[model samples]
Target: MPAVVVTNHGGDVPDFEGKITIYVIICVFIAAFGGLMFGYDIGISGGVTSMDDFLKKFFMNVYEKKKHVHENNYCKYNDALLQLFTSSLYIAALLASFVASRLCTKMGRKPTMQIASIFFMVGVGLQAGGINIVMIVCGRIMLGIGVGFANQAVPLFLSELAPAKMRGALNICFQLFITIGILAAGIINYFTSKVHPHGWRISLGLAIVPAVILLIGSFAICETPTSLIERKNLDEGKATLKKIRGTEDVIPEFESIVAASEMARQVKNPFSKLMKPSSRPPLIIAILLQVFQQFTGINAIMFYAPVLFQTVGFGSNASLLSTVITGLVNVFSTLVSIYTVDWAGRRILLLEACVQMFLTQTVVGLILLIDLKTTGSLNHVEAVIVVVLVCIFVMGFAWSWGPLGWLIPSETFPLETRTAGFAFAVSSNMLFTFIIAQAFLSMLCHMRAGIFFFFAAWILVMGLFTLFFVPETKGVPIDSMVEKVWKQHWFWKRYMVDADDEEIKEQVHPHVK
Candidate 1:
């Protein structure tokens, strides 16, 4: 038998049986495939748009504009329809999350993920084979709906299944897989760009691989004991809890989950309860983190790195290669987060990254503002410098805001409002992601190099927000965050007092220390 490990966070939260079991590892890696699908789309979309063959076939006007030797460096890829191809999925994701939240609540996280995979596979087919703009855009919309479901379910699934002691490292696997997917897309797009007239097809078609993996993987992993227990499958839930914990003595943990689920069943409407005082801390923090994550302009850079390289004077192949370098940086830096997030804690990494990103963003802005002219591109040396600086910025983001943005919210919400509150977080992320993906090229056209400073300013604000508003959530059990984290937070605690606490107090020993 595997050794039973019990860790206590000052006795404020429950100590449950936890071990690094192979069964749990396999389940998490499988669920994390959803992130791979998402990341591939993000990384591939920009590179595909930059492909000559891809543009010539679907967006001829933009392709012609790119061929002009005298085109303004900042405005070459500023077509609205082209931006729509990249951003339409996010808008779809935003709307689909509400429906996904319902499905996650009524069905289970596993089913929602399976649904997401099916939708993404269809999207991959439509996008790869699309001859018309309508087919491509419609495919993107389907992909968006799929992303909506996956994003809504995956993080919450990981958090619920993960041991509180190992939660940060495990939950972050979703982001780690996302970074790997981005890296894979970059490598594929680099080789595929060499193929004439159909390379983009291959890039878009490959999205189906991860989608298929996620679909098959979803069936193999057990439904989270939290979800199963909440859905009233008590016997299986306990058996699962025992298996995942690597121990037969899971009575305490199982009973705790059951108690929480019973309280959740009392609340007929979680969204309504989510607006009440007790829910404010998680709701506010979750939404703001998502909005701020996008405003950091991480997605802006990820979505258009290749285009930005081209604007800065790298040739087509060189631009694609540079994007690949940054993709590599993004993937490796995320590994740092996985190893250190549990040990080093969340705020320190986040604060350190804000400073690093601020300096890099500002320096890149200055370099572009000085060397990159409106009518002409940066010189070769300066262009190389710009890519290096952007790599530094990407490193800071991939390790810090990128993973924690999802990790924090997924762990913060109480069971009664967990899925519903997480839906709000997902919608907020998708909404801002859409805004950034859609407007970034036009914003570049208008703001020129000043766009970097704009994002840098937002990074500064994110640092301040983290300093004061965000509470440390290192070892608190997901089930006890209300009592152990939010209610204890200096600024957030005021929102904790209300009828909800008293009601929970009266009913059971759950929801508080």
Candidate 2:
């Protein structure tokens, strides 16, 4: 007989074993289309906004400002409406995430992703066919809602389906696909920028590709076994668990899930339960990760990559090309995370990235502060150096904050509050992303090169936060996270009530009095 492994939480903590079955692989890849769709919009908007034709059609004032030889290098593209085009999606995403949380717990992750795709495709149609700014912004709002739904569901879905041993790697696929989508958009933006009057339209229309893929994939994949079991579909959940685990002998795993679901049933309102002392650690960490992740100023750089490149001295074509290079770096660095996350543990990567990102951002800021000014651009060599520095910063973020921001929160919450808690995570990310996206250009206009220092300081805080508060969760099983992780952490442990834990232990692993 196989060894019956147990955890700090006893019988409910047994790690479910599973092969890396083809079915699971396909499902992971499909669900990750949500990330692809999100990244596409992020990359596309930046490049599209920089296009002359695009600006002429939708933002003529910014386009005219770009032509003036005397325009402040830092302030050329800081129009409110131009910023709105990129940022409106995130505010909409923020509102949608709460609704998405309801769908994730009540309707299922599979259906939530399907709904996301439908809305995203419609958004794509509107932006591509936009006759005026109103149509485009409305489309962006639609896209935001789609993003909110997808971001909320996909990470939780991946974590639930994956085995503990391989969870990090599988879950990182969502971020991997996101990086790939950004790279794809960068490439699309490059060629289409040459297509004249309607090139921007082509760029905007192609957002439909990833959305369509997600819509189709949603139909193909099954609802997660955990979701099904939680909803009281025991037989179907059992069948899915067998399929996903690639085994008929799943008795221990099924019992563990059923027991957890039984406990989940006792908590009628998951959000209210999140307020209890036991739930505070994950909730606090989840929101702060999203906040720090945004404050890293990664999106400010990403959302205006082409515009930023131009501000430093690159011509239009060269700026788009530079954005593509950074996109490549982002995608490849995320792969580094995929390989190392399960091995290095979360804290190591995150802490190491903090130092790297801090130094790079600081140096970049200092360089621009000294060499470039509000009136003129960087010298060609200096401009190249800035691009290289930005690439390093992107690399640091991609491998650490980018993926872990999603991965950690998804894994930390117990099944009882998983979707609801993750919704807060999703909305937190969207809320700050909206703030950064909306205000970044204006901040850039005022802060000039000092903006980089602002982010570097935040990176320092991120490192300190991770060093003291974040616990390593390299291979912990999902069901026993509170006991093995939160209950063991030096700080979080204080908030954990042993009596409540004892009660749960008694239920999952009963003993004769």
Candidate 3:
């Protein structure tokens, strides 16, 4: 017999059975395959560009022909072009996210994800078989567009479908798979780097496997209940709610969705409404979190770990191995957040992780600075310390911003403005990511040890921001607007105090649990 569970709103539901939980987990995992594609696309280029064969064939061919440069100069020119190539995807992603915001609302989440997967597959096909630089750049843009769509859709889809109790953990599937994808790419790069001209091709083409799986799997999942309700298909929404919840009594949840949708419909302009004083806190928090996540320099670390390791006196094989270790630490540490996010809450974890990252980044910078001042290169012990600090820094990020960056924005906005809100947040993320990716190698060239110091300072500022501004949203209902949810906080108390005491009392009481 299935156990019965009750909601705070005086409604009963069937406790989820093991089989139903498995089904939901499978669906979430499939959607998260997009994260794997994102990771592979990101991780592949670092290793491929580093390959002598790949550079000589694709980049050095043009430069050497025009300028007749030496091998060393050719390598330097190749590195610069690689950075542009890497960042081009993110540039495309920024534009795609804006389009995705409208398309997701118009087409529904499932269909939107399918479209992204198709783009991913097409992009991978072109990249894997490309004969020229122009073809490769075009492919990267397509993949970026796919990534932009997945970035917005996957988290929102999971948040809407997950049970309230499991929402945080379920949504984090996106970040977890991203780490997994990175790890897989790192391992592939390690082996493929030993091969000749074809190794880079194999590393890139492998992304197609996951893209195909995601494209097919997208069709099997039900449309989100909230999206269905928003479309005025109330009956189908109720059915999806029941299917996802594995319970017959979905009226309480269904009515809550209807009410939230009605409230959202009342707003005339979402972008304008988001700017009003009442809604500004959540919007600001969402955007700043994304900005800080990229500024942490995590992507720079992940995408160029091999190069950074080489700069610090490691050989090519050692650098590649070290990168794989970073990927493993990233994947395992994220499980900590998955287990504890609901229990530990978002605010504290983010704060503590930021502090840890700040310390690690500072230590890494100091070590490099000392090496430059004294030995002119790292000794074995100093090299070990640098490796340890990098691993710890990645761990801190994995357990905090990497997952929370996606989770908070998806949960922060009201139903009506959610599409636009999340789109803006995700696009903000891509914009910063593009800046960091494009500028990182240049910073390394110009600043050297100073680059780490820059990141450490940013981490400190992010920590302060988290301490003062970010509100606790541990178990808040997804449909509740920020104004309603954070009315008791200092920012909203003055504005909301006299607006609707009776309604506030009723709204606040039921979600108190």
Candidate 4:
């Protein structure tokens, strides 16, 4: 039998004590800068495309009214057009993540990010200067390729590098930065929208500056030590791990990786192995989590926050201001998750967040229905409630799905299969994000108040799925968990039957040297 290898299996929090070096933190932060770019790119487009008055000067006025005010409180035909512009990037991301995953696996993480940054810089530059809508779409497609690559590579790099104890918290920094970027974009658009009719150009153009920064920053980051070992460069891999952890006792740690890599080699082509029968459960779980994460309607809110606020009767600036608040709430609450993840455990936190979201979403739907029925504008009370519920939903998402969805898949699979599994999961996520994101404006335009109910139903289903299916993976080390997952029954089922079982706990968390 192959030796039983344990990875990341040190005792609670203490094992990571000295490993949290400032240099390591800097590396994590840099890898997570891609999240900033992801947020900036996605969030800026929503408000930027609404620069209809400015865009009209360059192209034909697709709508009769300026973006500020319209006859029926909608932008007419151009509303759909602007939404398409914002969402097409997601469609491009859907395709690009698959390509990125394969390429990153071969090229190594840092180089992959460097290549991605080049795409982002070139793409966003083209977007800002594009004369026609089609040109902008092409630029977004290019931007999506870069974003897709970074989105796949960054969180995986950060999660794998983060010490086990601080892993969840550190990895979640990506999600927090994502919200910060969103809030920053919202604030930037709010202030700049009135300054120039072509304000969206500034917002779109700003992304390139960060892309340039990322291109430079990528060189300083150490490639993931795990990848080094997989390439059979053990000595350098040991040195890299020591540099990352700043520790001398890396040889004990090195043994686990060697055994794990050997197991990985046995399962070598991840895509091919996933096609076999044994991979079904993990594959299903991976795909389902990705789908559910997107279907929860988070993207709908983030992608069209200003419009959603407008639909609820807020003024243009007020709608944008509300978006800022939404972003702030998302950022802060994700911090709460960062602190609590190791303490409360993944499954519990996710369950609570989902329930809170379910209640809040249902209430929002009912309020919208009542307003539509009464022909009444949302009074101060209703508006406040709507804003609060939106914040609540943002909080729930930031804590649970936003980061955890990215973090968990990185932890769940063995090294050989991880990239492929994560690639598929991300691709599935982008696919759904594309579908929901592109159709959201059209759905809201056609369905009006009923869209909330549609999302409510989806959120409800997701909560039940979590209650029954999603496993609790708090404090579990990555290496042993892989072996235990193969030997033990599914974690959720085992936990459900015997929550206090000692053996399960030990297997989930074996002692590390």
Clashes of each: 0, 0, 0, 0
lDDT of 2 by residue, 161-279 (tens): 98787789999999999899998999999999999999999999999999999998778898999899999999999999889888777788888789889988877899998987888
CA lDDT of each prediction against the hidden true structure: 0.92, 0.91, 0.80, 0.74
lDDT of 4 by residue, 1-513 (tens): 221122334333113322677778788878888888888876787676555554575434543543334333323333556656777777777788877777767777778788788889888988889888788888988888888888888877887776666678888888888888898889998887786666778888888866887888888889887777877888888888888777767665576667778767755477986775455555677788888888778888888787677667777788889988998898899999999987787888878877888788788888887774322357777887899999999999999988888877777766777778788887887788888877886776676667788887887888888787776666555655544453354543333233235336546875721
TM-score on alpha carbons, each prediction:
0.97, 0.95, 0.90, 0.89
Better of 1 and 4 by lDDT: 1
Residue 508, model 2: Cα distance from true site in angstroms:
17
Off by over 4 Å in 1: 1-4, 499-513
Residue 440 displacement in candidate 3 (angstroms): 0.4
Q: Write candidate 1's Cα lDDT for 1-513 as tens digits.
A: 466466766565668878878999999999999999999999999999999999998889999999988888899899999999999999999999999999999999999999999999999899999999999999999999999999999999999999888899999999999999998999999999999879999999999999999998887899999999999999999999988989888898899899999989988899998988878889999999999899888999899989999999898999999999999999999999999998799999999999999999999999988888877788888988899999999999999999999999999998999999999999999999999999999999999989999999999999999999998888777788878887778988887787456676866965553
- Predicted candidate 2, C-alpha RMSD: 3.5
- Cα error, residue 346 of model 2, in Å, equals 0.7
TM accuracy, model 3? 0.90
Ranking by lDDT: 1, 2, 3, 4
lDDT at residue 426 of model 3 (Cα atoms)? 87
lDDT, residue 356, candidate 1? 94
TM-score between model 2 and native: 0.95
Error of 2 at 9 (Å): 12
